[model samples]
Target: MGKVTAQTRLANQLLLEAIKNPKNLPVLSLADWELLIRMGRRTRLLGRLEADLSRIGLLAEIPSRAADHLRAARNVIDHRNTLVKWEINRILWALNGTEAPIILLKGAAYVQANLPPAHGRIFADVDLLRPEERIEEIEEKLSLRGWLKMQIDPYDDRYYRVWMHEIPPLRHRERGTEIDIHHRILPRTSRLNSDPALLFEAARPLEDSRLHVLAPADMVLHALVHLFLECDPREGLRLRDLLDVHLLFQHYGQEQSFWDGLTPRAYKLGLERPLFYGLRFALRFFDTPIPQTVRSEIKNAGPRWPMLWLMDHLVALAILPGHPDYPYPWATLARHLLYLRAHWLKMPPLMLARHLLYKAYLRSRGVRGKVDLAKLDLRQQ
Candidate 1:
């Protein structure tokens, strides 16, 4: 690991403390407030910051400048969330006659369910999951409703169709809102055996809507899998995602059934390891209230001590924001390593090597407009 300057440590620590306890925030000096806002914004947690403070009634006491930044972040999320609901309504309208079930995923799920994690959450696009057999039908319906696949390299498109969990993203012609139609939680080629059938069987419906969401435990596991297994390192580790895990755990952990069922569900989906990592980090960063018995059971799913130790360091460096002007070299190294680790976890060795070589070849040839190659769904094309 590269050296971390005291300034960086202090900055990271302050941001973390504020997240853990927003009530302590009103005491921060102006200079500290500046650091907090920058780190929160970089981590996409500024709106979350606003939400947390407001939840605890501390938002009104925050310094005016900091509060302004927080409110602005919240406003952006509010607008995006409004658009998300409208998009989903339009999606339902488009698929009115179709009998296939559609389930909201990630940000859209959190919002529609009115989960705690959705409070002030910023969304870039909407995500949906449907049965694989109905994927083509869903895509067709959306296309007729003005949603079209994003143009990309033919190879990449083939990759998505062949190996990915979702098709190439679809964007509406009029609103320009993007939607990812997924058939499963993980890629078809991924090592984890996350069966969409299991998810669909357990999904719960929304009130006054045809759409559904994963059951509570499934929701938590999906968030963790996305956090620990499916992240694009180019985007860095989102502290916001970890915060989502924290909030999900916080809300769901209130029920004994949620705790009892979580680990078993993860095992059923071949996602125990991600569940372990999610719990470990959420506990570490947010002091999430997990039951001791649940903690003991999850321990069996963790990596060995040496591997766990190494992962702790790597995750800390990659997830915690450094100074926006001077990011730590070790943090960049950690992101790249995690990027490679994600691919290793997702693909078999031979296929991974081939896919990576092809991607490297494209980059070497000055492929500027290629989608973030790290995020591809590999294909023979």
Candidate 2:
């Protein structure tokens, strides 16, 4: 664990600021400014990452044609605004001919509610929720419009179908955008069995359409559950996700009845741990006004200390990559091994082993040209 050089720290700050407001690129640290300039000139490198970024809906603000050039240049970035506008347009289009209700989740809802329109937060995909009955019809409509079923492995597809709430991923042929159309937030394997109708019934109009956004309490709960499912304890577990909870709680401080309603729902659903962690972090880091009664209620619902500690470490590892900032290398590896063991328990033993072997083969191929493993003797360690 070595101290980050002053130069690296400045570069990190500039990177954060760039994500916050890409249009202010001129104000970045000198080192970062240099790197940006150099990257702007590297046509191949810039082209590839930009294409990947645009494919993932990260450059939605920039017109697709113009985004190609800007993503390749030193031009001050305004890509996030483009992405927000583009998502809104897409949602509007999806609603045009359909009577089915749409529920916007995660980053899209947060940006609409909290951040400035042009802030440069990156979202890899948009998630939407529709009725279980409409899943087939909606998939058909989207498929007709160039959104096709993702070509994932059969085992992974079955995993989602059986254990999860949604189908496999869908990628738009034209826009190259990916969307996860979910009927429920948590996996089916979890104890939480909230009615999809409740989400629709609670819909609020965002403009002309009666689209559903989670109630503030439910939104916070959803964010926590998402992070827990991802199992990445890092700040990078989607900084925007945590920011959404923080900003929402700040804007709408809930009362006793809110806590009363949430507690029973959470306990019954077995989401107590994720909910507790979400609330704890939101209240801890941000100035969220949680009343004492509500605090006590959540505390009682939360898991015991050891589980909390594990979650805390996982979150840390997710946000901060290396040691000192997180657990030591061996400890982190052991933790991940245990996590994989649990994940494998949900699948057939042979399927799990095959998947692991395939993953190892891919990893070895990825490193083949980059490292001389014979000299390093990786197996000795």
Candidate 3:
């Protein structure tokens, strides 16, 4: 096969976005349109991307059967509200009876916030949080209900349990859904540590029941960390996640101290880079009105500039692809290299080798791949 040019890769990304938002489709030049239309129909994935778009209100402008198929796949993954309510009840019931404080995260809390219902989102797994000590017991309980522990490699499991923040993902035999049970946010190895008890203590009751969820600030911070720090390459950062941050920030604007708290909290947790990237991108793309003090503080944290820039580009590529909205070519990757070098300088040789070995293993298992660097628009600069 011929090497895929950056232009081609970008065109593919733009086309996917166009398919999701049909209004943008017509604006594509004829050559771009041909390329997009060809690629749009080629996905082999089993999920409904169309229903997800509709659920998020992006389908109105780009209405098409193609989009509908995507939506259908999303519907397949996402449980109906009734089902979600029932599942929430099941988990809540279990937690309440056992004295385990259940802290709902992401979509579960989003739906309860009334910003949008969770039915349209593609949520194959439910994420629930409890105290760290209760994880093994909770897993045992979930096991009895036919939720099996996911059979990852033993080394991966060990790494996750020891260094990572969350347990290995669990799958339900009957429902075929997954759940990520967590006691903290960042990985233990990452040097960022938040008190799980504090998160649980700050939890408030969901609208329908006694089941509690993270406070808005905590939830936003969690989402930001997940998006930037965790670097889930497969799913990428969806527009919905950014929307959540924007909405939550707006809602909590009255709490002037919120952004102030994030600085020390992020620095203490070794999550300053992710938080900086999240806030910068949220403000830049989503028009999130970040406070001036926070912006100044981020500017002052110049050491993380390289990583933050690279992440911004990665996020833009993940979200918008090859379209005009994509960032200038090679900028992020170059900065990322600097960031990596910085880490290489500090980390002990054996520890660094171990981390690289694990990363290589993840890539070998199809977790990472070349990110189409050739498709970048290098000519613009």
> Which model scores highest in TM-score?
1
lDDT of 3 at 284: 68
Candidate 3 Cα errors over 4 Å, as ranges: 1-85, 93-96, 116-120, 232-244, 254-270, 302-320, 323-349, 358-381
> What C-alpha lDDT does candidate 1 achieve relative to the native structure?
0.86
- Each candidate's root-mean-square deviation in Å? 4.1, 10.7, 9.8
Where does candidate 2 clash, by residue pair? 60-82, 60-83, 61-82, 61-83, 233-314, 233-315, 234-315, 234-318, 234-319, 235-319
Clashes per candidate, residues 3 or more apart or on different chains = 0, 10, 16
lDDT of 2 by residue, 47-111 (tens): 32343344455655544544545454312223543564576567567656888767777766755
What's model 1's TM-score? 0.94
lDDT tens per residue, model 1, 1-381: 234566678788898999888889999999899888888887888998899899889998988989999999999999999999999999999999888667999999988889998997898899999999999899988987888667678878888999889899987776879999999988888988777899999999999458899999999889987887765666667788999999888898888999999989899998999999999999998899899998999899999989999999999988888776566888888888888888888879998999999888888997753454334442311
- Descending-TM-score candidate ranking: 1, 3, 2
- Tell me which of candidates 1 and 2 scores higher on lDDT: 1
TM-scores for all candidates: the values are: 0.94, 0.65, 0.68
Model 2 gets an lDDT of 0.56
Off by over 4 Å in 1: 1-3, 368-381
